[model samples]
Target: MTRAGRPTRTVLAVDGGNSKTDVALVREDGVVLAAARGGAFLPQTAGVGAAVDVIAETVRQALAPAAGAPPYADHISAYLAGADLPIEEERLRDELIARGYGGSVVVGNDTFALLRAGARDPWGVAVVCGAGINAVGVSPGGEVARFPALGRLSGDWGGGYHLGEEALWHAARAADGRGPATALADAVLACFGTATVEEAVIGLHLGGLQIARLHALVPPLLAAASAGDPVARSLVERQAEEVALLGVVAMRRVGLLGEPCEVVLGGGVLTARDPLLMSLIERRFAECAPHARLVVADVPPIVGAVLLGLDRLGAPPEAYERVRAHFSGAAGRAAGDASGEEVLTAPAG
Candidate 1:
């Protein structure tokens, strides 16, 4: 029920990753009315049945309030992080529909959602460097392609988790004096609030420190490298090269990189202000893809999820800019409007 005496049409948008799941309900005009979030739903991390349950629970929580609220939840859309294969998509979609969302569910990988946020041409590439890394390519012919992401063993790299692990490995080696001495040894010691690498090691062994916490070392390490630290410089260069390789591989998979193409970069590392990584990535991409142009995406991943929902409703291509505009405004936006309640707000710049 609305002040206008009409039912508020609503769409549910969800973004599920290995760490957490987020769901939100938005009006057709893009105003967020309600949101909810839940735990990890990666089938590989949590069992398939468990992942399905988490997804269902998150979506239900977001829609549950709509039953009696002014806005009524109707259609449902989801962009999930590990739902890469068709079977995964089918299984999740079936479960969502069976759970009462029925017939109005749109399910896809996070890569697809990110692509929707960055490019309207449908023939562009999207590269993300988050806890993990992935790339998606959309052809003008409505065909979409993605490369197999085999975590670290694929010889492919560049992601927060991977980079964090790398930082730890470097520090461990440097501490053991088995590797070249660099500013990283001092930086790592300082990051763990310790006076020596031995203290940091003791903290790591005692479970007081986390592997992911090493991600905090990345920016300073990159800075040290930019200031001429060989070890730090090498790691940043390798990450940049690998990310660029992923973009090239994805473009080749979709058959659209040689002559003219667009590469959209998203995620934490790429979004950072470091020019070394971006510069190296550009140099690599230029050599591999020739005419490909790498650019930053205007919309974040949440907006990508919203776009996928709109696409499910058959919204025209022109809807992208409108939706982007709607969410970009402030003042009237609720406390947790843009991102769902579950999303941890990154510290402000």
Candidate 2:
């Protein structure tokens, strides 16, 4: 698709979440020139203007490494975590358009990026469980299923951030003898390198500890769960159950229950490959829908963003391969490759 001149930035793809955002610059023919990761894109917590700044800066970083990327792109597609409601998506879209990063702009829920990245069949289900939890389902008959995903108010559950908070709560209670004693208290101390939960609390209140670091505690929490910590184990189980519940509900709503369809999962929690969580999900899902095949999304969600851009271009298969090859040496590449037509992740819908 290129003539004699350098390649221009035809598509700008972004995957924005509560914790982080990724941006990539792609040519019209689907060759990725640059991909970069940046700060959080949670408009709810960070204000729309600040969140948009982060996104724009990340877009700049993406184009930074590209030798021939145009200053303006033909299209910019951003899937953001806090953009759950239609109003939110439109507002964010308008803000992005005002920045003039691209001639055309589209903003959607971050789950949609995961959906397009993981699903290749044009219809299926996707459940994302990283810092937060959300699900989306698309049916062949053109039905769509999703949730407000506005956290507790919207009946959402099972995410790394929640898991960390629960762990902290139990640990604090155990320290004060108000709850059943579990290994989590000492585990928390070891994880944070702190003397006591009291010290941690005081530090946080005194503006010493960054509350944002709370989500990072998820790994230690999972470790404690795996090491026979009852409360931790219970929390992990609940998360697995929630993941299963979301998938089952989404599929049922879209009329994909018991059908031979793909169930795609992504985010840090599911990607951890935890034995208890994985087994519980498999067992619970099999009971609900035995025929639904499950897949753990291996590639970065930004790849899903790229796929969304390519879809609009209706690029040839070879163009897809070119884009996949551009990410071949990335730190987050899948075990094999996405150079083939097959989608390595995302839901079909």
Candidate 3:
């Protein structure tokens, strides 16, 4: 309800990534009202029906604070990691409608939200490389294109997981005398402290070692290449090239590269302070997409989801900034300890 006693329209924004799900609520004027976070609900990782349950539950919790108020139905915009498939999008849309969100729902892949966050302009490209890699671009006329990212067997590649795995693979080959000796073998072996590469592999499956543990290997791999390890050097170079290629495809598909457009970079790997990898990516972009500038996303993807929710309500850019500033200040108050509601309230512009 408004201070003048009139009803207000509310919307929910959600970002479901490979590792986490974050949801937020906002007013038409753009103040964030509430927010929450949970686990990922990608059907590819969680099973179709199970993923639906996770998403439904996450939504229920996110909406609980304001549910049952006037305007029983609310607007909702969700960006999910594995909803690129139409069937998946349809399933989620149907579910949202059934849950009474009605004529207020938008479902899309996670990459699109990152793109929207980096550039509100209609035509732009977004490339994300963390545990995985993918790219997407949209044209001013709403045309969209994406690259196939089917992982190793399909040569669908780029990102930290693949890079770390490649380092280990070559290290094992070198240890077995089938390949030239490189510093990666010694570096990775020290990472695991196992006498052999085979033992390190076995220890990974024994389960107490968190998968995040492997994230530690990425920097050393880059360091090895910086120090002139040929295999590691080639691996980083190839991965950087592939990521750049993905960005180029997005820009060209949307007819934005030769013109004015922003190519946004997001995700953990890109956020990492690796000078070599960063420089290589910038160099490739200079060659393949001279007109597209790489902009770092200003807010996390969930905030992008919130902006998306407001966008559906026709909120102006100033409206977004007002609320964004509020949230930014609020988040700063408590820093890392901010709760979901606290984070939402931070954007009280």
Candidate 3 residue lDDT tens string, 35-82: 777777767766766775666566667678555532233687888887
lDDT of 3: 0.73
Best by lDDT: 2
lDDT of candidate 1 over 109-138, digit per residue (tens) = 888777766665546888888778888888
| 1 against 2, candidate with superior lDDT | 2
RMSD of 3: 6.5
- Displacement of residue 166 (Cα, Å) in model 1 is 1.4
Model 3, 287: alpha-carbon shift in Å? 1.1
Q: Which prediction has more favorable lDDT, 1 or 3?
A: 3
Off by over 4 Å in 2: 2-9, 65-71, 332-336, 339-349
After TM-score superposition, the amount by which residue 20's alpha carbon in candidate 1 deviates from its true location, in angstroms, is 4.5
Q: What lDDT tens digits, residue by residue, belong to model 2 across residues 1-349?
A: 4535744447888888877889987876777777789988879877888998897788767666553433457888788889999999998988888777778888889887777666656578999998889999989997999999888999988687777778878988999989989777876676666899877766666878766566767877777778888888899889988998999999999999967888888888887877767777787777777777787766667777787787776666776667655664464565366632232222232
Q: Over all chains combined, what TM-score does candidate 1 have? A: 0.81
TM-score of each: 0.81, 0.89, 0.84
Runs with alpha carbons beyond 4 Å of true place in candidate 3: 1-6, 56-73, 101-103, 153-155, 205-213, 330-349
Give all candidates' CA lDDT scores: 0.71, 0.78, 0.73
| Candidates in descending lDDT order | 2, 3, 1
Please give the clash total of every predicted structure, in order. Answer: 0, 9, 4
